[model samples]
Target: MNLSFFDQFASPSLMGIPLIIIAMMFPALLLIHQDNRWITNRLSTIQSWLLHMITKQLMIPLNKKGHKWSLILMSLMMLLLTINLLGLLPYTFTPTTQLSMNMALALPLWMATLLTGLRNQPSISLGHLLPEGTPTPLIPALILIETTSLLIRPLALGVRLTANLTAGHLLIQLISTATIALLPIMPTVSILTSLILLLLTMLEIAVAMIQAYVFVLLLSLYLQENI
Candidate 1:
């Protein structure tokens, strides 16, 4: 029984083949594709509007150079948003909950931004390692600290998404289990727990959306600095 809770996170397999790839691709397959129509349906219109809003918000802090990333970042945000929300469904696995997957998504993008900075403006980029006004004695220490912080960015990005989704899933599972266990013996408490579970599910939905935005937003910010 103890192991069963964690089993939900394990990748499901068919025969001997793992289905994780399918799960990862499932969300993208749900998106509506345009068929050369100038006028779109209501669903497609809403999707387009939301995409426009998100793109506008993300690009506001960035310069023209950074605007080149609009398509990539928007697609990433949509992918993450869809996957995160899909994970909340019954019997579905969330790839974002895996540290490896999140890191894979984070590291490449983070490295790209860092590389862009280093290649385009090496002096300015390296200058960020040590503040201009620092005293001579503290220069070495401050550089080390800042360097460490810089290296930790991708790690933090991965762990943040993993931890938040994992905790919320675990909490939902625990509360759901308690509600089920109490249904027969304590009807009143069971109902109360169910109500709380409902509220938590709603909150988790919001978290799913916000975390996706935050992940992309931070990437845009990093790009902003580099550009």
Candidate 2:
């Protein structure tokens, strides 16, 4: 619950980010180093195959016209996604839980949406963003509402990740403290709490993946709708 400086530096960032960025890149580098050998073969190919499947499933749209741009987006998504899930391990820190980290990811997408929208349709970019059809008299009110909602994307993204990770970590901390306190006669509760924490850990993994995907999906859709 505490955003202490000691805890922040507990996971030292090479350049103000988690080491997981480097960790995640290892698999990608391995695939290249092996000359895509990981993709071939049969028995020892499941994990690589799954990674390929995920990359393909998510990278479909990105593979189109702006391939390089797509690569950038997918890379960020994959890297963040890996970090989110892997940080659930014992003695690990989830960077996404930090506001600075979350803002680092969200702000770029927000700016991209705005820039792309303007680039694609400069004629009435800002004006037309207020829904296509509305009562003429409510023009000012409608524009205000639409503008507020549009600007909220980054805020929503940051809050969603921070809230989820903080809540998950808090629950784990509470359970751990409870188990320690009950280690006397009610040893069974400690065991039960450990099991529950394990279950929640697994759920956290899924939530991590889902949150990354949702962020990327929403970003792509935002671009598509506006641009």
Candidate 3:
């Protein structure tokens, strides 16, 4: 019974083919392509407006060179947001809940920014390891500490997304189970629990959106530093 709660996190497969890939691709399919028409439908208009707002907010802190990444960042944000919200649906799997998937997304982008810094301005990038006027005794220790912190950024990114979604899912499941179990013995308490569950579901929806935005926002901040 205890292990059943964790089973939800496992990647679903059929005939030895993982369906997580399909889940990841599903969001992109929902995006509508714009035509040459002068006017568009309400759905398309709303999509365009949201994308515009997100892109504008993300690009505010970035320099002109960083703006080149607007498309990639916006697409990533939408993908994550869709996956998170989709996971809340009944019987749907969330790819972002897996640490491996999150790390795969994080490491490449993090490495890209790091590599960009190294390629464009090697001196400035290396200078980030140490500050000016540091005592000789603390140099080695500070470099070690900074290097460790630098290496942990991608790991932190992956863990943060995975942990938040996983915890929310677990809490929802637990509360739902309690509500069901109490319905037979304590009708009043069960209804109250159900109401609480409803509120938690709404909060989870907000968390789903916020976490996606945060993941992208941090990447943009990292890019800002390197660029």
Candidate 4:
């Protein structure tokens, strides 16, 4: 009875008011706890462990200059990871599914990385636009092309996250609809389809975790190069 499959991606609201504020606030669920004790709860322990492992991995390639970003990068990862997983639940709204939200997440950090590079190493950063030993004939073209590619990175990041989550959600909705529709006419087929849906849901969970990691990982790499 919905108007469209795309309706789920719409900014869920009540009585003409948008729920983006609530959606943004939902990541607080990942806070786990704020206890300050000798022994931590298991949930807090797991959260700390995950953050430590990810930070260690990302810091391996980065020098001390880039190490300052560990907390910021990890926070973004946890926020995206929590939101993506929460959205998989029935009747949940996913702000990350929107290009604007993803772009907002991507742009400032990307700009930070770019600005850091430009500020710390102007010659090297500008040098990236043109490789060494370029012939004079292609100098203009190469710089223009590389500059275009550089500017497009944030757009690519935003689109990639949005498209992956949106596609997965759409597929889940379509299959779920089919499963319900088949229940009355074809119970056996419906059961099989539901099994497939279960597997797909598991895959989506993995995808959610991965996309979050990749988003942060790429940013770390960006910061690594600049620092």
Winning candidate number (lDDT) = 3
Predicted candidate 3, C-alpha RMSD: 1.0
- For candidate 3, give the lDDT of residue 81: 97
lDDT of 4 at 86: 92
Model 1 clash pairs are none
Q: Residue-wise lDDT of candidate 2 within 1-227, one digit each (tens)? A: 45542363245577677585555455354332234454555534765565567557655664254343566667677767777776777776777777777888888977887787688776566766566778899988988888888888888888888888777777777777677878786999888988887898788888888888887777776665555
* Superposed Cα deviation of residue 180, candidate 2 (Å): 2.5
Runs in model 1 deviating more than 4 A are none
User: For model 3, how does the per-residue alpha-carbon lDDT over 89-206 read when each residue is reduced to its tens digit?
Assistant: 9999999999999999999999999999899988998889998999999999999999999999999999999999999999999999999999999999999999999999999999
lDDT of 4 at 109: 100
Per-candidate Cα lDDT values, in order, are: 0.94, 0.70, 0.95, 0.91
Candidate 4: stretches off by over 4 Å:
none
Off by over 4 Å in 3: none
lDDT of 4: 0.91
Looking at model 3, residue 33 earns an lDDT score of 86
Compared with the true structure, the alpha-carbon lDDT of candidate 2 equals 0.70
For this target, which candidate reaches the highest TM-score against the unseen true structure? 1
lDDT of 1 at 226: 91
Query: Number of backbone collisions per candidate, in order?
Result: 0, 0, 0, 0
How well is each residue in 1-227 modelled by candidate 1, as lDDT tens digits?
A: 87888887787889999887898898988998878988889999999899999999999999899999999999999999999999999889998898989999999999999999999989999999988889999998999999999999999999999999998999899999999999999999999999999999999999999999999999999898898
**TM-score, per-candidate, Cα-based:** 0.98, 0.77, 0.97, 0.95
